[model samples]
Target: MADDYLVRIGKLIRDARQHRGWTQTQLAEALATSQSAVNRIERGNQNISLEMIARIGEALDSEIVSLGYSGPMHLRVVGGRRLSGSIDVKTSKNACVALLCASLLNKGRTVLRRVARIEEVYRLLEVLNSIGVRTRWINDGMDLEIAPPAHLDMEAIDADAARRTRSIIMFLGPLLHRLRQFKLPYAGGCDLGTRTIEPHMIALRRFGLDITATEGLYHAQVDRSIAPDRPIVLTERGDTVTENALLAAARHDGVTVIRNASSNYMVQDLCFFLEALGVRVDGIGTTTLTVHGVPAIDVDVDYSPSEDPVEAMSLLAAAVVTESELTIRRVPIEFL
Candidate 1:
């Protein structure tokens, strides 16, 4: 059994090396080892230490082994330890992704301070990069700078990345204004069971957006003649739904009143971001949002979304459970 496991690990290492386009000799040079030793390691003829695996992973920039337990992790807690320290709340994942989608609305450079570096954000960034948008992590990966090209290559969008995140639906709002027609992969994320995108379609249709799902893709067409003449009511108060409506409204030339909007923390963050783009949004933190749309957004903006209230609450709960006195800083008090 141990030999089989070693062989599997060896095969993974060999595959990663080949993916990096490095020969065994090159890998040996990088690892300061002989090519024969490397060949033996790859053939499972020699045992490799965890330290060597980690070095190889770093050299190839691939996670050869996760460096943690392979099975389900079990944590045994021993009570009686008081936790008495200040914890600064990180930015919210929900807000970060919403803002990533909102970045497509701006023609000028957008700098988001202390954005959450989560998988969802990374997947969105991948999709953004596959298009013509230029995204970079600055401030030591704490901040994100997004700059959209004058013309986005919708054809070049990363379908694999798009399919990994359900947030891809948020693109409909921004893309509707940019492209008369485009196709996006079907939204996919956690296996939370078959959640419907019909609510999103219902909300966005008010902005003249029509979607047809065929062959695992959403074929979207925008009717330019259609504009929101009256208040647009959302079928559901979902965060992404409210965000999609706001994205469509941001570039409209007239005022857009969105009813039944979600005033959640993430939604509020998107509203604030839209405001920074020179789109006037009234009734933030309320169900009714009055968006004074702009014809175009072309201005550099810097905005920092508030910390995650959910994380703050989790810390608070931990302190309470441990009978500890802890200071959770930068909590979004409004959300809590």
Candidate 2:
């Protein structure tokens, strides 16, 4: 069994090196090892340490071996088994992740109630923890408490964790207020074709954020001297883009108006969260938002995000498909 595992790891390393168009000698030079060693490692003749595997992964910019990752999950469904019970929908996954990134805006503790413990959230937590943010699970692991440090160590961010979730782009809105310049790994998630970040850049540029993507890293520079002199118009009314604009505007210390924003459920949840942080938002369920930005936020806030409409709909669909009577609770009807 151990030999089989080693062979698989070796194959993965060989494939990744080939994908990068690097020869064995080139890879050996990159790792400061001999070509023969690389050949042995790729042929499973060498017993490579975990540290060496990690170094190879970093050098190739590939996930050779995910440490805690699980294999594909399978669900065997049996017919005639009715799922009939009271189902309580958890908070919106999109909103939870957006709020998690927004927590960086607050210096004091931020407690989120009943957060969805999805893999995306876990990845973001890993990135946050790596950047000097203190996070802990409380209340039987259903609640999350995030507290930012006095100084964020941006250089110590977990690039692997950041690359696994596309939501990491939301960090730009909050991090800009804290760090003048920093580098973030490019966002990665499900393969959904080429999703451009141009809309995000167009909106963020109003707040003096200039991003240059080079070599799988976004080099971000913020000019604090620049502020929105006029109403900022969004190029695309995307939910995350609107949230990013809101995040950038949250600390502008002026009345900033955003046009063509998304009035989706997640955006509303984020607006409510911003309000809790003492940033006044004029429009809650409208496309246009006038934000009264505060120069700083350092209050401990506890917020319970509303239930996800999509989850509630999924439960309803399951009940209908199985011909079972299920009581779905906490549906955000406003969104539907």
Candidate 3:
């Protein structure tokens, strides 16, 4: 446990140094130590004293260590303690998934700011890693950095990790742009009844993908010649479905129109991300989106997804149920 903390703190120091555009030698000078000593500290090869940790935090202007307060998970006194202060909503899991899949579209490095440290994100990272994409959590684990492999090792995919979330469906759109043939396990996650994936198939087929589901797997084949010459109308306005279409359209090299689309928070965040990738998207907040696809995307982009509306709603529901006064910040009122 002590070693783990030391490694995490070391990562925090390295991230802070990079953020400030400082070299190891520069940081070593600031710390009045040799570059080799600083390197050892950053690599977690040397144990650091608390005084040195505090000095490093001060030098980097970061709170590398945190003391979290634990609270009861269950109600024992009928919510006797009234909540009064405001709390900010964290980043969205949906956006994080969308952005992770979208990162495959870029050949350069992708940096995401303040991404949420959720199980879903961790699973997605596992899948990405299994397929040869290099990823790391840095900047006190608030940021994520990803670099795509020259060629993906599809056979090495982490099937267990990929099956943990239904967000795996979003991979269809982006992967279509990268591979001509690939197989994915049946989409899994929270069992919210028998929700059909027919809509996803319908949207992706417009971009020349043919998917066949049989015996717990989806065998996907792509026809490189297929492109949407006209507007593609989605059968459903589901957020992941819309994001799938957007991911496909992003690298299509022509204008693709999507109707009956989702204007949800995650989809909007995806649109902004597509724009950052140099794809033009119109109607970001509405049900119709016109995406002018580019032939290629190779930019080292940095993007920050919006706050979670569902989280805000959860806080509001807790406050109302407990009859306690609380404030939720960054609610993304448009979602309401």
C-alpha local distance difference test of each model:
0.86, 0.88, 0.85
For model 2, what is the error of residue 289's alpha carbon versus the real structure, in angstroms, after optimal superposition?
Answer: 1.4
**TM-score winner:** 2
lDDT of 2 by residue, 145-245 (tens): 99899999999999878887889889999988998999987776322123447778888888888888655578899999889999999988899989999
C-alpha TM-score for every candidate: 0.75, 0.76, 0.71
Angstrom error of the Cα, residue 1, model 2: value is 43
Clashing pairs in 1: none
lDDT of 3 by residue, 1-336 (tens): 348877877888886665444578988898999999988888887899888988887776667777676875775565556678889899888898899999999999999998988888898999999999999988888899999999998889887677766788888899999999998765662221235488888888889999876544678999999999889999888998899999999999899999999998899999999899999999999999999999888999999888988888889888988788887877876746
Score residue 4 of candidate 3 by CA lDDT: 81
- TM-score sort, best first: 2, 1, 3
Q: Please write out the lDDT profile of model 1 over residues 1-336, one tens digit for every residue.
A: 349888998999887776454689989999999999899888888889999999999887778987556799888978888898798999989998999899888889999999988899899999999999999989898898999999999899887788768898899999998899998877762221234577788878888898886555788999989998999988878888889999999999899999999889889989988988889999999999999999788999999987888888889889988999888888887744
Q: Which runs in model 3 stand beyond 4 Å of their true positions? A: 1-82, 189-195, 314-329, 333-336
* Alpha-carbon deviation at 131 in model 3, angstroms: 0.5
Better of 1 and 2 by lDDT: 2
RMSD of candidates 1 onward, in order: 9.3, 7.4, 15.4
Backbone collisions counted per model: 0, 0, 0
Candidate 2: segments with Cα more than 4 A from true spot = 1-83, 189-195, 320-323
lDDT of 3: 0.85
